[model samples]
Target: MRIKIKKESCTGCRLCEQICTIWHYKEINPKKAAIAIEPHFPEPGIFEPKLCVQCGICAKECPVDAIHLEGEAYVLHADECTNCGICVEACPIDVLYTHADVPTPLKCDLCLKCTEVCNTGALTVVRRSD
Candidate 1:
């Protein structure tokens, strides 16, 4: 599964980020969330919601084999990660990020928790074809 972002529909309210953080970390921290909303202020203001597309780029770039595909979701093996930051660099959309408190990388797990709280329908889960 992967998340489809509607950039024009996003209002910069950060509902998706909030829900993601709360669901995964049990907190209200936006920095810990898997999804990010980048805002372009002044002149033409736009809210760009960036998220993982589950393209497996990170998994293929992992030198330590820390990233793997489990079913349709690409997950990170924290214990095996070397904090190389290769996954973060490998992400084409720049959605993968390093944990603030940990040395490991973090990406969207396609849990669909964020989509549940997104009132604007800016975030939607796309199921795998297979």
Candidate 2:
């Protein structure tokens, strides 16, 4: 699974962030969500979803070797992770945001919650074309 974001369509309303946090953690806080919408202030209007590119930085930086490829997805074995924050530092896009209430890193599952709730059709999930 993969995520696709249309930057041109996002409005910075952050409804995507609201639904993401609620869907994953039963919370309304955007800060707790794995997905992030960054505002490009003073640029008229531009909101871009900082998407997880499924790069293996988290797996590589995991000192405990807890992160691994499971099918097409990168999963964290919660029991094995030490929450060292190494993965967070390793990510080039900084998409590996930490869970607010947990020490472990959070990754996008590509489950389509963001896509389903995108009123602007800005986010999409697809089978990897490759």
Candidate 3:
């Protein structure tokens, strides 16, 4: 299943990001989180959650074939990754991210851990994984 993001409903609490980061990395670092929270300030003051929708563009664009679809989410094999950043650039949704600590491009795996802690219904797991 994929974690559907309702950007307009996001409260900018960053709970999803924190949970995802702690679940995967055992730390409370937003920079290491696969999910991201972006804010639109000034007039409309809303937050946008950047999550993996399993578009598969990152997998198709991987030159080393290191990326693949695993239960509808893009899974990057870090051992096979060359850190070329091609797939990161290929992401249309701009959810794929690169960090100094990570050699492979990181994207959400639809683990649903973030959804468990979300109270605002901003993040939810949908049946569609394809």
* Best prediction by lDDT: 3
> Quick one: ranking by lDDT, best first?
3, 1, 2
Q: Model 3: what TM-score?
A: 0.92
lDDT of each: 0.83, 0.80, 0.84
Q: Look at candidate 3 and tell me the lDDT of residue 76.
A: 84
User: Comparing candidate 1 with candidate 2, which one achieves the higher TM-score?
Assistant: 1
Candidate 2: residue 63 Cα off by (Å): 1.5
Model 1 Cα lDDT, one tens digit per residue, 12-45? 9988888887887788787888888899988479
In model 3, what is the error at residue 13, expressed in angstroms?
Answer: 0.9
Error of model 1, residue 77, in angstroms: 1.8
Q: Estimated TM-score per prediction? A: 0.90, 0.88, 0.92
lDDT tens readout by residue for model 3, 3-53 = 777888899888887887799879878788888888989768889888878
- Regions of candidate 2 where Cα sits further than 4 Å from its true position: none
RMSD of each: 1.8, 1.8, 1.7
Q: Candidate 2's error at 77, in angstroms?
A: 2.6
Which run of 10 residues does model 2 get worst, by summed lDDT? Answer: 102-111
